[model samples]
Target: MKIAFYGSSLVSAYWNGAATYYRGLLRSLAEKGYEITFYEPDVYDRQKYRDMEPPDWCKVVVYEGTIDALKAAARQAAEADIVVKASGVGFQDDRLLEEVLGNASPRALKIFWDVDAPATLAELKSDPDHPLRQALFKIDLVLTYGGGDPVVNAYRSVGAAECVPIYNALDPQTHHPVPEDSRFAADLGFLGNRLPDREARVEHFFLDPASRLPGRRFLLGGSGWQDKPMSSNVNYIGHVPTRDHNAFNVTPMAVLNISRASMAENGFSPATRVFEAAGAGACLITDHWEGIELFLKPDEEILVARDGQDVAALIAGLSRQSAARIGARARMRVLADHTYAHRAREVDEIFRARLGARMEAAK
Candidate 1:
């Protein structure tokens, strides 16, 4: 299968969460014998911000110039077996959508793989000015990184021909327990970029817990969090490179998972961090969400916290033996059911279904 992935910064993970997701999925697809080409625009100083060099597993093509350049690039979409347009291309270019849908070959499968389903859906629902709302109907299939049944159903109701939830999963090879390092070792650690909508949730779930546990050290990693007023117990370490993520997770007593506001509101949207933490054999404390138990069994493979008090209580009560047990179980669960290989398989199945349907319609 020849697959062309159109997403934001597939070559650069620097401070972009979507970059890691794209790399994992594309690498997995390549392992499955798919010839993959990742098409990302050279925007946001992405050339300077690259974290991982293009893997030997697949090809990375960076598109330069204006919207017209991207439109010209869309001509390549004619040769692909599948063309995926992921959310957050980093620029507001409505023409990209029109070009992808209009220019794609009849044989090529067009997909809108939404990494940020909640935010996209919410914006489209409330705002008349949202650009991609009308474009959704043109795609053959819609896939989401997270957001369970509800999100899938909602997308379909809104004109998606079909919707599938390919939730975030672990890449065990990249994420596993490492020997404790003094730099990352802490009682609790939270890693995520700062966004306005997620700030309150961060304060409620992560920062508040650190404030309550003054004696225990808490570490913060991720971009755009420097100016925030953190408690004395919390130490901000700026951005941790994707390469060092496993080390960061493993060294912590317990890693914290905080969903963005849209994700929390939409439910079932676990960030890439959740899988990363689990894959690293790190005991995780996450804010409660409806479909969380589907991925990680609460109190068995994971711990759930509703608010600051819940988080503080969970941390204070977690014993070393208990934490180790939960961490092990979480890792086991991820390795068994939640890996990028598994996700790629799901995507392949969906593509087959869409292709079959198109053929049937033609006949």
Candidate 2:
């Protein structure tokens, strides 16, 4: 099957949190003999700060987000079996969705892949006349990164034909145990782009913990965090590339996962960092969120902190042996059940079932 996917940026994780997810899922799909063409808008200085080179596995088209470019993408997408437009697409997202969904062929399966399900659902629910509300009805399927049943039900409630939770997963080849890098060494670490939605949680779970344990070291990684006021114990490593993720994970004594407010409130939304840390055999401590047990067994595969006090206690008291044991267990669980290959196969299964049902109806 041929699939055309439109997203923020496939080549740069500069500000795009879903870059790793796209690369992993698309690469796995390519390996499975499905032809894939990725369309990414060149915006937000993503092209200026390119991270990964073009992939040989699939065709990646970097287009200027303009009316002409939108026309070109629609033309290219028309020939594919499936056309996907992801949420949080940097520029002109609503226009792109309208054009793609309007022009999609009857044979093409159009999907609205919402990586930020919580935020999207919130917007749609809060505003009855949101543009996405109309766009949602035009799409064939709605897929999410997290939010599980709650997200699926929310989408359905908002006029979606079918909704599925395709939660983020690990790509062991890209993220696995690596020798520690001295530059990233710390007692606790947090890696995420600085977004308003998550900064408060970061302050509560990571910065507040750092403030509490001034003697202990803390590390922060990712873009958009420059010039921020942090505690003396906290060090910022701007924009750690995906290639160095394993090293970054191994260097930190225990990796921290702070969820965006929308994701936390919505529940079941695990950040990409969670799986990345687990895959690299790094002990994970996350802010408390509902449905976490569905992914990781708290106190076994991972640790959960309700506040700064809990974070400080966890960071200060966690032993090396216990960290290693928990990390290893988490890695094993993710590798067995949550991987790009697993997600890719799930997409295939969904398509197969839909096709079979269509054939049966025709007969």
Q: Residue 238 error for model 2, in Å?
A: 1.3
lDDT of 2: 0.88
1-363 per-residue lDDT for model 2 (tens digits): 888898988888888899889988889888888888888888889988888888999888999868888778867877888889999888888888887777777777889999999889889999998888977767888989888888989899999999998889998888999898999989998899889998888888898889999899999998878888899999998988888889999888899999999999988888888999999999999999999998899999999999989999998899888999999999999999889999999988887777677667768
Among the numbered candidates, top TM-score falls to: 2
- Residues 1-363 of candidate 1 have per-residue lDDT tens digits of 888777888778765688767777778888888898887888877778788788898888888847767987777788898888888887545667667778778778888888999888876778655567687767878889888888888887677777888888888778888887889978888998888888999999888888888999899998889889989989899988887888898888899999887788889888898999999999999998888888899999999988989989998998778988999999999999888889989877777777888789889
Residue pairs with backbone atoms closer than 3 Å in model 2 (clashes): none
Question: Can you give the TM-score per candidate against the true fold?
Answer: 0.95, 0.97
Q: Count the backbone clashes (under 3 Å) in each candidate.
A: 0, 0
User: What's the lDDT for residue 42 in model 2?
Assistant: 81
